[model samples]
Target: MPTHHEDELDYTPTPHNVTRARTRTAHLAAAWGHPALAPDVALVTSELTTNAILHGSLRGRLIRVRLAVVDTTLRLEVSDPRAERVPHPREASPAEQFGRGLALVGALCDDWGHGPRDGVGKTVWAEWKLPG
Candidate 1:
């Protein structure tokens, strides 16, 4: 049986760091021999990190970007420092500029959810099942 493989990185909540997280996720997916999952993974990273920066970020706190592979499933987790700002998918108006990140995450991943961390903040995660 294949064992679970995972890695994580912490980043200050910033727009530039979101890009860095996305790039790192893409690179990791490829290095793990799942290049096909890179694009979607990158997109999910972008959405999650951006949401963190906008809603969950706090002073002196950092966001965590985590990637994991268990069996054929690939997981991406972004943990930010605001437990109060929970995320949910909602309809975005045509005139609105935001409010669709989770929707996009849902479209790209097989499963996604969020939960509070041990002390403060919360973790938003998405997972995709690799093609067998």
Candidate 2:
């Protein structure tokens, strides 16, 4: 039987940190014998990391990204230093320049939600079903 494991990586919210997070997720997915799920997971991580940097105020604060593989699901959680603002799916107009990240996340992910992390910031999480 294969054992399930959880992998976590924490980093500061910078413009270049997104790539690092994606790379870490990919490696972990491969290690867990789920190479096919890497792209989707990486994309989802990219969206969350981007949102954390863009909307969550990327000061000197750090962003934490966690990846876990359990059974047939892969979970991605990104935490940043802002708990005041919550994420919601909003209707985007043709002329709108923003507010499509969560929509894309919803379409790609099996399910997702946001909530406070401990006493600090908020964590945005999504899960992807692995293909057999």
Candidate 3:
């Protein structure tokens, strides 16, 4: 089937960009008639963006957020300038405030993975099946 929706954004690698990405994801989801998916989308976006900013690219580079719906699956992709540092879900302590993002993404998403982008970076993606 043809893609039902697609959008993307490129932002500077600054801390504020995390919030910007999340907000944009919410807007896109809502506009696509999936407003209820916004909260989880925002959460996933925040985590991936923050990780990209913190671990992937922090200088002289741009991070990208791409949203797409193919068939009935919603896919979110965050690309950063470091292909070598792929993210993985790990166990976090109860009191830890860090390193739970991938875990949350794994729990909330139907599937997620990372792959090399065309250029120097990697795109981390998460997918969810939308209700019919």
Candidate 4:
């Protein structure tokens, strides 16, 4: 079995950091020999990090993103500072500009969930099964 591979980013909850997080996720995925999954992984990263910035943000707290390859799965996790702002997929109006991030995550990833982090807040994670 391949050794587990991991990478991480810690950033302030700024709008610009969402793009930065997406780019890093793509780079990590490609470096792990899963370039074909880069686009989808980037999309998921963008959605999750955007949520972290918008909903899970706490003053003076930073968001953390982790990317890992374990066995044949690619996993992405975003940790934020608000534990109460749990995420779920919900119906959105066609005219709505937001509210669809988790829906997109659900559509793209094989599995996704959220739970309390080691300390103050929560972490949202999604995983995709890698092709042989």
Candidate 5:
């Protein structure tokens, strides 16, 4: 299927770049004719990139963010250089600030999952259905 709108970016994994990713996701969503999805897209972007920065990043490796709109679906993917450290969503206790990122992604997107990338690393993706 042909893509309607798409963008890919590579960023050095850092705490600052997570905000950049979120802003970019929101901008892309609005430009793609899905303004209402901007917030959710941005939230998902933040969650995924933050997780990558905290858990999957390697020294001198870049994190990749890809956002695309195809047919009636909007998808966002975050790639990091760690295949072994996979993500699993679990309930978080009130005192814990972490452990809720994956859960939030799952709740916000229609579907979300992670898998190995080309050679080294993994790609975690989330998708939402757009208005038809």
Candidate 6:
């Protein structure tokens, strides 16, 4: 039986923190009998964290990560303190500077979306189907 509580994993926005996030996700997946969901969750986490570090205000704000499993579906959300810059899927040329994170998220997860977080910043989320 999975615990039904509002669990949240929050951490600083550092490169090493990304690995920590991955490990945490792995543990959560294993506990919920959804080890296969770890990789996709890790990928999404990486993309979101990287975006926060590169484009958002990372002075003293910590990146908030929340993971939950409900009805055989795993929902992952990464929130940062920057609402001015919203993520959008866009076309990129072969020689483009940078632009392909959200695209990868769309391809990996069963469903993904982004929205404002309490009028402060945006939370990019993705969900994966758990194995039976």
Model 3 per-residue lDDT tens digits across residues 15-108: 8989999999989998998888889999999989999999999588899999999999999999999999999788989998787889899887
Model 2: per-residue lDDT, tens digit, 20-86? Answer: 9988897888888888878878888988998888777557778889998777778899998889877
lDDT of 1 at 123: 92
Error of 5 at 76 (Å): 0.1
Per-model lDDT: 0.91, 0.85, 0.91, 0.94, 0.94, 0.78
**Candidate 4 residue lDDT tens string, 1-132:** 664899987999999999999999999999989999899999999999999999999889999999999889999999998999999789999999878889899998999999999998999999999886
The best candidate in terms of TM-score:
5
Runs in model 1 deviating more than 4 A are 1-3
Task: Give per-residue lDDT, candidate 4, residue 13.
Answer: 98
User: Which residue runs of candidate 2 sit more than 4 Å off their true CA positions?
Assistant: 1-3
TM-score of each predicted structure versus truth? 0.93, 0.87, 0.94, 0.95, 0.97, 0.84
Worst 10 residues of 5 by lDDT: 97-106
Name the lDDT of candidate 5: 0.94
lDDT of 6: 0.78
Q: Give the TM-score of candidate 4.
A: 0.95
Residue 50, candidate 5: C-alpha displacement in angstroms = 0.1
Cα lDDT tens digits, model 1, 1-132, are 574788899999878999999999999999999988899999999999999999999988999999999888998999988999999789999999988888999999999999987678899999998877
**Weakest 10 consecutive residues, lDDT, candidate 2?**
1-10
